[model samples]
Target: MTTVADAVGWDGALDALAERIAPRFCRPEARRRAGQYLAGLLAPVERKNGWQLAEVAGDANPDGVQDFLARMRWDAEAVRDDLRGYVVEHLGDSQAVLVLDETGFVKKGTRSVGVQRQYSGTAGRIENCQIGVFLGYAGRLGHALIDRALYLPQAWAGDEERRRAAWVPEAVAFATKPKLGLAMLERALDAGVPCAWVAADSVYGADSVLRQALVRRRIGYVLAVTSGQRLFPGTVSDWVEDVPADGWHRLSAGDGSKGPRLYDWAHLPFRGAPEEWGKGLLIRRRLADGDLTFYFNFAPAGTALKELVRVAGTRWTIESGFELAKGEVGLDQYEVRSWTGWHRHITLAMLALAFLTVVRTAAIGGKGPGRLGRRTSALDRAGDPSPAPPAARPSDPKTRHRYCLVALAKTSPAAGAALSLETPHPNR
Candidate 1:
């Protein structure tokens, strides 16, 4: 019997995601059915991978199913975009931040898409893996991953021999993580999401291309910086008169305006800077918690340091995002292997995470996830059970889907921050 549940079906969420993967890639109904089928087929303890995921998602013959998935134009980015659209629509024009970070997926064998022996944040050591540079956003309504680019390895770029053997596309070139990050910021901007800023760790913050691109695009950014990084504004006169870099620049810190925070400027042109770069105020904030430093080339001098700190702090959302995504959800498990399969699985896992984030935002408020200080009686070896139903997806075509992440934020951590989502028919 063909059955669609009367209440919510986790797979049912896919039915609304037309903004993402074209229906032709995998019929939403079929994909949902395949996913549900797989969910039931896998043992409770089974890993999350395509081999197992395909068992139920597969057709009468397993090989044909494998071939079909590989051949499809679909990739995890498509689903991630779907989840992004859903959450953004729900948010409805509140200020939000998109965070960029690279995650490593460990692979023992050769031939996983973009896998190489490299530094993996997940493993905290050098290992064979594919590094994924991703962009995520969260605000009053919810949070979701928006875009992804596989870190095509330098090996593929340097070796024509391996390039030919691996069929690495000719366009692939040696790009540092920051370069990939710049492209992602551009992608978010191009999508026209209502973003106030971009955030990331020192890896991206230190890269000149990333900071320059954000400045060139006039997109604001906050990123952690290595203590050694230098920043300063272009030469300008004092508040009283136009002056050059040989002048003094200082900023007062704290409520009393007497805090130790201060910076001195060395005015310079965009010339000595990195490519496509503009020169601006550089702030060096030293504190006991840790030393923080960065440069803001585009913002006005009066606001430069504040903007830098705000942008730099935005990285926490993704850091908290990772904490919830990995610990609360089973993101670390590798129950699948195909390039297509791994992404597909991660996409679904992200969907669930997005769903919960929305719930927490709507029902309560989701600023960012916070630790409870100890394991809660609320959590267990069994994964967070599904959360209660959310208000219907918002009706505005501009923003209606991402109740998925609300599911994650709502279920376990309980959205420690304020959720700005409006209730459905509050009058009733």
Candidate 2:
């Protein structure tokens, strides 16, 4: 089972990454602290806040680290662009998916930028928190968060005193969450990040302006839509209500912690469309509770239902990315309250996550340890959904490993070894 991960000289990878992004830091001290900050993020620290991260970075106190985050001269946006380019260069595929989603950062105080008593997905309820809209890149190689925007509610955006206190820029105005996601998508597309489909939850999907923008760009999407979304003449719920039981097809949206996320799916195409471009509605019914979800799909003509389902499943990839970034790289552990500090810390955390993904990809040669019975179902072809028996779950003994190079680098110092630590499935 020894792969490139075992043999490839990965000791210099982080150093090489630091060198690659060195120019982003204007001063030598900033450049040096940047390396330390990234390393601290990668280090096995209990909490990745200023003091703990500083301790991991061998600093006597948190003052330097805090200053680095609060007043660092480096441009977080420029670093974000570098992160986008790096992820694309390593994990890029023309068939890759660009996923948009948001995660909540639970904050106790009102001082944090964009913090409000809003619905926090992280908390699973309405809580005082800041929402960060993120863009994730998912290819056959791997997935990583590449771009991020802090959601600024109108309350914060319009308040001049709070804006001054938080250093919110004058140019930054109130934009909806979907608008933020669209802007990130536009940035990635304009930079030629190379993605085939965009997958997202209904927040973005419900926005006709965003959907129209994607359609105008000729980009495909499998966006979750609310039940009330208009289609042709009748609403989505009305149209899907009449779909015969025989019309439903069983498919896996993607792999989950247990196994394939199997569900019954049905597709209903829009009546009018260009011959080249296909438009449709995709429906998913949970086998356990019969709960339903809907997706508005757009793609080239003759695209298989399997492909659409695959894109639909890709939306979950960003969720996994969020979990990994937050769990592994302090994505949600920042103590910063100001606008600049928030972006800087998040950008660095994202960079750390990207570094891990890239290293893991290189080590494993872009393949999971074992395949979980990848038999193509009989229903994969013919381009429609129907009901079928679920496939038997295979016994996959090996768990997916989270690779950390920092500990290895610490031990080997010269030639970094790979530390393959067992972790729950990324899809969990």
Candidate 3:
């Protein structure tokens, strides 16, 4: 079998990424282990646990690989800084959105850090899992996770023994998912990761504090809210369900697999006095079932409905990032049991996914790295040769990456097996 070293050297993109992240580690051995870990992640290993990764890296002792993740002195945040820089360099856009969402990693035991019975969107039910809140940067070129935080339940946070066993920092405290999302947003903004809007699902959107925090930063957002969310149109609070039938308008948020994700949309102007900023309620009524979803939007005055809809649509980009990262880079396939180890593995996996996204974009002839503008449709980037219309490929970026990976494997037999892991077991 072709070795992992040969596979790493076979791809210029992988090599460049390795060099990019090498400086984060002070010790040469640390750097070497980091490279080996990344190579194993990018390798199409069936199970990306420490032992499998160590075996692939040609290490006699798997404990060394575990040590790299568990005890390495490198700063994972510095690597995150590098990741944000790299992503902005390639996919940054003024109109790009910084998206927030959380994914669940199912675990077997209570010993694993932050593991508890929780609602996992990945499993579509309550499961024993650890939750990870992630922020993704999405632009015309593509999207990739820029930062992440592991969510600790209140039980885990209050138990000192459990916390110590997990190596939770002394300063770390119990924080809700939205708070974690806000902290990540602040970090991205502090690093000057350019983005025009912030988007998230109702979990974060329903938090009035999170919304106010965004307003304080002068950052615009289109965040989903529950139907019961109250809004004021003229000093009178009104439930989103109170809107009249005539208030709704047919609009397409963005294109999807079948066609446009058409829905009945309506906007209610806020009652507040005219100011530099604007607040409003944007509602989407499903065409098929009339199931309504509400969004709380904050933007500059005169912002068009299409733009608000566009921002709301961008929420899926983070979901796409999650799916691809888990499927291709083993985002949740770690054996680590501590807080630091989880961050180490996740950050490295994110780096691998970012590299693959960049490669996939370049391979599919995506637009040159440039300024962000109006949203770019996926059809514009797909360099499909078949006579079928671009819509045939669906606007999903993950599909594009899969196709590119398959093509790359065909051209390079040495890296084929390592690049062709089975398709992600359907979401759960």
Candidate 4:
């Protein structure tokens, strides 16, 4: 059974997290506004828009919340740095994979920054929306989105008036999603995020510049590509479809909602003496429909197929993380229309999700509190002394929602801790 002490401890953990990032805000009022906004986001609210969030935060005027998002002087990037430090501290692993993907935020008006009729995987069709390129860190500890970039279409990029109205910086220029993904990857590496592999869908993998950047960094990756993408076994003309049926080996990328995601896999090494990092074409054929997919893999020579397949499997974690953030934490429910406001809201939402991830990890006996730089793995927590008893398990969406609300509602001295920062919540 849950106890008051347990609730206090949970609240304390969240408060401690907020304290860690509170200094990022320029003023105490900004910090308080940030804390309240985050609490409202994590709370069980049907709509997490400005008005709804402001009401839940006990503010009579929603314009205050809107102003906080629009005119606040807080450093969103500093909060992001804190987030990266927190994630690396708790979830860092030598074998961790950094996954890249983009999600569409549907918006109706043309005035919303970067909104255009475009293809959204979220909707599975062309829709009017803005895209946010995201980078996720997936390790044995757990997965969470650590970085994000707003995708500005070329039309908006060329339109100085629209850019100025949206508060986009003058130095900001048009960059493709893959370039954005690469920039995030570079930032993660520079921040000392311990990762061995990277994974992404074809949209990124198709970019040779991105693949080359990964090779230069000596980071391994299993990135999907179109069948038409050229492969070089003996010659550059070779394509993924050239692989013979006899070469295909049945394998499972990883577990899916239904069961093992089994497929027929094959690989062919690129021609010429292999560099310190090897190059190859990895293919997957569906077991039932016989549909084929391809990946351009870069790893050390003699790397096993299973390792590449495992890295490929890690790609889905970002998707799962997206679903969880959007559904449970209102990642896509924002009413903000400007670039800075969007970043502020999304960054806060990510901070909240990180807190939840930490809570979930602690509940499962994963790790205890400590400074951000010290290395701690799920396997290394056995020797660490416990700080407080674990909070209740947040395995259920409704249960998780209840925990957030209850922890926020019942104010204890410990609960006085303030600001930290979805995907749709998905069934386990």
Candidate 5:
């Protein structure tokens, strides 16, 4: 049946959802105002109360607005569990790959969470920015966002001066980006949602501590290492089969593509501390339109080459999520200046991704070729881990899926609305 929301444009669907989820159940008036404000902007424009922004959210009445939302903390755990069920149930037998990526929001000044002179994906260079760690869901059925976290740079944890300058909350402290990524993965596992493989870029991949941590947890992974990354080089000449080829050979991909062209690796069984054991190695390739590269990993035996490719390919999917959220969906365009406001904007982006994923798979049934999603072409790649006993197989149970854009049913022209026949279509 046609609903009032279907009659409007983009604003309709988001407005309907906001009402249903957080709705001004407690502060209807404030939330109502907040809803209207967000519906108007599509860029990083300032929101004003009067002739400024068409609609403004937050407390109209300082006391009621602040009191209502202030008392509210984002239900991150609840949000994760809900998204997990909705996403996994659609999996069927299809393998779900978790793509880990970090995108930075360029901040003009300090004070934003995790803001530092770091590499900003959005800006494509090093700058002062806020970094968000994310997990993207990919299978034949759909491509969607799964979880997120704001990386609190070490400055926030170690230096009191920077912390004070950046307004780092007394409760907020420094945590590594990988640590945050691990926390997000654990949340999904606790909720009983499992991924077939985890993939990342060199930043997280090259971290020895992080790699060992994943090995201990027994999570299957693939990561890119710098050309200079250290590894035991196995024997070059073939030797006796049962001789226990303990001899090591450490080689380099040496400026292969970005760093080196060839790889130097060893297949030593997982060794070192418990968290660093229970793993082996695999070198997989992603043959996309862009230049394909080899990945160096410490994976167990019996892992499939194709499955590793799929998981590694998943990293490209997160790039799509970031592009759509930032450009088409208004991720960084929010006008709210507070820290809470920044997170709320990102949460909305996540919700939008989840909502779109569910709709495309369940209602629209994603199917087609050469849709909106672009293939990946990253200069570097990475992966993740969990400390545990070695698993019997490389990846878990298998499934198949192919994805495309959601088939949105077109709505007839809105009733009682005027159309400007002479106005040229802006898209033209």
Candidate 6:
């Protein structure tokens, strides 16, 4: 059995990445500690807080590690710039998708920077948490978080005393989540990080400024919007109801854990764009319940429906990337409170994740994973052991073929078992 460490030069890869960003740190001690800090994040430490990280780094106390985060002289943005270059060098794609989203970090007490009562998707409800807007790159090679901004709520941004205590810079001001996302997107574009499409949920889609900016850039997008949002003439839900049966196409919006994310997809094109640009409302219906979802799409004329579906599907890559980073690289395990501390820790963790992404990409022969380090297989298409027909099977060829494969597996257990053994289950 080949372990991940054996397949990728794990230590050497980390060392090379550490060396690549070494110039970001001023003092030799800060440079050395930064490397150690990154290693600690990549290590199998349970909590990944400062104390635990220090113990893993063989330091007597947490002072050195804590100082490295709080009082370090290095600029987090400089290291972030290097991180972007590293990702683009290894995973760049001209048709790549730049995904913008936010994740919440649950925190206690009143003093933690940006911590307040808010709705956290991580918690599934309203709670005291901090939100961080992040930009991710999904390409032919793989996906990883490339840039991040800690979202400061209106309360914290206005409270002068809290801002002083938390070391929030004077230039920092209240910016909505969409604004933060737009800033990060602009940074990625200015750096020439290759991408053809942008994907986001309704939070950013509702921002006309962001959408118009993408339009001016000549970049394409598949941005989700609320069903109630107006689409020039009527609500999006109204438009969805007007689509006839023949307009719908059953397609696989890329593969998921179970198999292809089979959905009923259709779009209503908008007129008045230049000859080169196409605009429309893309709709997706659930096969199980016929529930509807909507997206605002902007692409070059003659772009295939399947191509838009592919761009829409790429949105999941950032979600899976977040899970991998939090699960495998301790992306949200930091215990920092100050503005500087948060950025420093997050940047180091992202670097660790980028290293893993590059190594896994190489191991998988540059055939990108459905999620980072994990690829979908024929076994995924082999549904249940008993091969019962789904309640609502679409007439699409891909959907029909999936059922056939399931039936074949049931009829030939030996062949199915052989196929299962030939393809390794992904390591969590």
Q: Which candidate is the best by TM-score?
A: 6
The sequence of per-residue lDDT tens digits that candidate 3 reaches over residues 365-422 is 6433222112221222233221221111122321101111101112221111222111
Full candidate order by TM-score, most accurate first = 6, 2, 4, 3, 1, 5
- The residue ranges of model 6 lying beyond 4 angstroms of the native Cα positions read 1-8, 366-428
**387, model 1: CA deviation in Å?**
34
Deviation in Å, model 5, residue 300 alpha carbon:
6.1
Cα miss at 158, model 5 (Å)?
Answer: 4.3
Better of 5 and 6 by TM-score: 6
Q: Each prediction's Cα lDDT score? A: 0.50, 0.79, 0.75, 0.76, 0.49, 0.78
- Candidate 4 residues lying further than 4 Å off, grouped into runs, are 1-5, 232-246, 272-274, 366-428
- Candidate 6: tens digits of C-alpha lDDT, residues 176-276: 99999999999999989999999999999889999999998999999999999876566788876555445566777888989889887776666555568
Compute the lDDT of residue 80 as modeled in candidate 2: 89
lDDT of 6 at 310: 87
Count of clashes in candidate 6: 0
Query: Worst ten-residue run, lDDT, model 2?
Result: 399-408
TM-score of each: 0.61, 0.83, 0.80, 0.83, 0.60, 0.84
Backbone clashes per model, in order? Answer: 43, 5, 1, 14, 37, 0
Tens digits of lDDT, candidate 1, 73-147 = 444454465555555656534457778898877777766656789999878999998787778885645456666
Model 2 per-residue lDDT at 113: 89
lDDT of 2 by residue, 1-428 (tens): 55554434343567666766666676788889998999999998888999998898888999999888777577778778878877877788999999999999998989998999999887899999999999999999899999999999999988887887787877789999999999999999998899999999999999988989999999999999988877645567776655544446677778999998888776766534455886777889899998889998888876766788889999888999999998999999998888889999999999999988877776577343222112222223223243332212122221022211111001221221222111122222
Which pairs of residues have clashing backbones in candidate 3?
44-418
